[model samples]
Target: MNQLTVFEQREVLGKEFRMYGTPEQPLFLAKDVAEWIEHSNSSVMLSKVDEDEKILMLNNVYNQVSTHGGVRKEQWFLTEDGLYEVLMQSRKPIAKEFKKEVKTILKQIRMTGGYIPVSAEESDEEFLARALVVAQRTLSKKDEIIRMKDKQLEEQAPKVEAFAHFIENEESSVEFKILAANLGIGKNELLSILRNHRVLMTDEYMCYDKTLGKRVKRYGAKHNVPYAKYDRFFEVKQYPTDKINRVKVLVRPKGQEFIRKSLVKHGYIQERAA
Candidate 1:
């Protein structure tokens, strides 16, 4: 929390506890929470908290608490949910009061967007307790707009990364199976889709192979022929060695994008999990 400094302490609240986190989502020092809840071992108390709810901060030369100093080298802070979990797990009599106090403070801070009200009768300790909330009331309109835009970008990060991945590949040509994998579709499934959309045809017709002078059956290769929109996107190579003398389809990089969009429009492409 960008806490309102009590007695000129930014990270510490009235020397009672240390806070770390944005005023919007305040976090507490694990040791302080443990001591308040009467947990004998801070390490043991934190073991029950989820990994995502806890973060470790290490002391460094840049921070006021230098590594060369005799101070503890590391600290563990708990998220609001984690703090609540620890309080509920504690059997101490003060745990209930501590939970209620923290909940009330958090509620006020969140409701007011990190600018909580102070009461005339508020004690020094009570004021410090609510100090975890940052006062954002003075933020400029431009900064607020930037913050909202940043939040939107954060929410769209997964989609942005996916599109980047799709567009950044340098491969000039990709085999059908490999292209299908990149598109998150099975090889056979993609082949079926192509056939269903008439992008591929498998009708057997008589054709003369150079190796075999006589007439031989060959499957249709519409994607390699004219009048097809996606025809240029595909490279169909005739394999005359096989009895059927079938064609193997390969996709160019631009063709991959075209096929991807087409498949997406036809509801055939598999969506990757965000």
Candidate 2:
């Protein structure tokens, strides 16, 4: 019902077909019109309807079978079947809506027949870069979560190490054990005490250093622990201090036997008591 313009056809098929099918815009000639018609799986074909080749057949349904005239005007005329096919080709408005419709349909059919399927894998790095962008975003989020967990552990490290030490070496029954179980002092603080303070050892006994008396006194006073003359006093008492310090047990007449036992125990005098 309407005349199709060169601009309208170009809009549907793109600029490649700009000069196709008009006085100023001559359409591309098919390589073999007879072969195209003979092998027609679709209802339309493009063929020359005049000797000058200016006029073209848009459809050939009836004349394709009839022998009335060779390449007549009726053969080139756009048929109802051809117009139906053309409207299905593109949504763009065209001049001589009926004729342009047939041309549009024929153009689309020819283009589609020549089309080859494209492989997505052939795009290579373009697709890969898009994929990596998404992956990096996810990895960055995971890294942030890991850093947060590490910071929390760092803040809690001293508390965790203190609890582990209590479970490990607290059975030694050192005064530090009582202090740690009650007050929660870290390992570094306890190590500082052992280094600076004089620790006297006995068989299951405790004694304080005579050298660091002031330090022990100050430590106990600051912490509200009872301060005494001996920082590590023994729980069990054995012998007199003077006699135990003697090298010759025979010099002590009152506790000759005790002296001999002490000397033998210490490996100072080896005579067995008779």
Candidate 3:
């Protein structure tokens, strides 16, 4: 048998396990597995096993490999069955989660063909080409995951905005229409007042570049150039109704404060005792 080489390491719940062996048969270090289980649950002890039984198990499955520096190292490795026995014998509750993690690692190793070993029949160029293909596939998988996360964020934006509005207005009972009527102003005028005070934001627009004959689109607030220079090249786009409604000034407590202060200053309502 070839000297065991660590091909993969995975951290599960803060404990680490290393996968070693060739693509045909994968083995895990028994000592590392025991340490991981003990770290996960301090109560379960591997030392309870009889010394003779432990020696017998090690003698049947362990490997002693010679290193290039004239050093011989003895490493105890476990097969799937051996690992199952070790985990099942433990009385810790975390043993179940550890078993599941082990299963996941085994599945991944099988799916990825465990570890790639350089064969005597294959040249260096061929091995490099195979490794390059695996790397490209891994990168593509990562890109797919990122795209999924972005889509999830886009879908949840409106809900998150609505939740924030609920939290801000949780203590206030005033509605938009009721507040406008109380202030003796139209709803649009109330919104305009808040916008003027920087308590509310205006609808966003998309800016384009007609001079370059290219659609270099930019968001209203994110545009780098002055709007006066590109006013003619921009297209007015209303913000999404759901997002607008969620972030409306009348629905926010701070907007109510601004309205109250403005009304008191303009004599719409008599100033109350401070």
> lDDT per residue, candidate 1, 15-130, as tens digits?
25444455456667787787676688899988998998876543221343323223223356788889889988888777877777666656755565453557899998887666
Ranked by TM-score, top first: 1, 3, 2
Which residue runs does candidate 2 get wrong by more than 4 Å? Answer: 1-126, 172-274
The weakest ten consecutive residues by lDDT in model 2 span 246-255
Model 2 Cα shift for residue 105 (angstroms)? 46
- Against the true structure, what is each candidate's TM-score? 0.37, 0.18, 0.32
Which lDDT values do the candidates have, in the order given? 0.60, 0.33, 0.51
TM-score of 2: 0.18
Instruction: Note each model's CA RMSD in angstroms.
Output: 18.8, 44.4, 27.2
RMSD of 1: 18.8
- Global local distance difference test of model 3: 0.51
Backbone clashes in candidate 1 total 1
Clashing pairs in 3: none
* lDDT (10s digit) by residue, model 2, range 14-112: 222322233323343231222222323222333312234322322222323223223122122333333333334434453135345345545643443
lDDT of 1 at 165: 85
Ranking by lDDT: 1, 3, 2
The global Cα lDDT (0 to 1) of model 1 is 0.60
The C-alpha local distance difference test score for the whole of candidate 2 amounts to 0.33
